[model samples]
Target: MSERIKKELALYKLREIEIDDMKLKVEELKIGEQLGAMNYEEKVQSSMNCKNNDYVMNEIETLEKRIRFNEIANKRIDNALKRLDIDEAEIVRRVFIEKKSITLTAQELFKSRKSIKKSIDRAFEKLKLA
Candidate 1:
């Protein structure tokens, strides 16, 4: 995968939270807290159907689309990580998921910095194909 995508893998956990938050917001809108979204008569009549309000429906659709995109990205990264060997996966998790510096990760793994860097490179290369 490209560097952009690899880096996005670092955000996988955050994306999970974001997707849930967005779904909650969409559910709220659907359940008719859409008071201000629909005008007077429309508000009274449309409480039964918020989709009558173009803006609210558009917002819900947008949120759903974003949730889908984040889910797909998370799945892609998860699949790639699963394809890695144990050592490579651990290195990727420490450096990317845990946001450790290479030196710190090397120290924790009890390896030299050069060995850690080489493993990272190899993992990324394999990830691209995965």
Candidate 2:
């Protein structure tokens, strides 16, 4: 595979991880918001709740930015895949987009490991040119 395609695949994988992390953060923030609301009765002594809410809000904003970035990256990947041949696109989708292991993808596609690898390499080459 060409270095450019490798870099793009690596970036797509990293963005997938980032998206998952951002989703988790968003969920945590939502839970925190719920908890903070529940503690509204205790607003007398622990003014710390207000501070915590501010922190949670800041985290939510950061998470939103990450989600938007991930969305854009996903669209780019989709466009790239669309430009590829069907078989090449399937290989790329299985390996990168679906996050499948090579062996697993091979099994699922009823292809030999070597064949799957070759397809992946060809996909990368196509993506590099694209």
Best by TM-score: 1
- Pairs that collide in candidate 2 are none
Q: Residue-wise lDDT of candidate 1 within 1-130, one digit each (tens)?
A: 5577567867987898999999999998888754455556775564554445766779899999999999998887778888888888898888887789999999998999999989989988887765
Q: Which portions of model 2 show Cα errors greater than 4 Å?
A: 11-14, 38-47, 95-122
* Candidate 2 all-Cα RMSD: 4.4
lDDT of each: 0.82, 0.80
User: 30-108, model 2: which lDDT tens digit per residue?
Assistant: 9868865845466444578767777788889988997998879778888988888897788878787667899999898
Q: Estimate each model's TM-score.
A: 0.68, 0.65
Which candidate achieves the best lDDT against the true structure?
A: 1
lDDT score, candidate 1: 0.82
| Candidate 1 runs further than 4 Å off | 11-14, 31-53
Point out the worst 10-residue segment of candidate 2 by lDDT. 38-47
lDDT at position 123, candidate 1 = 88
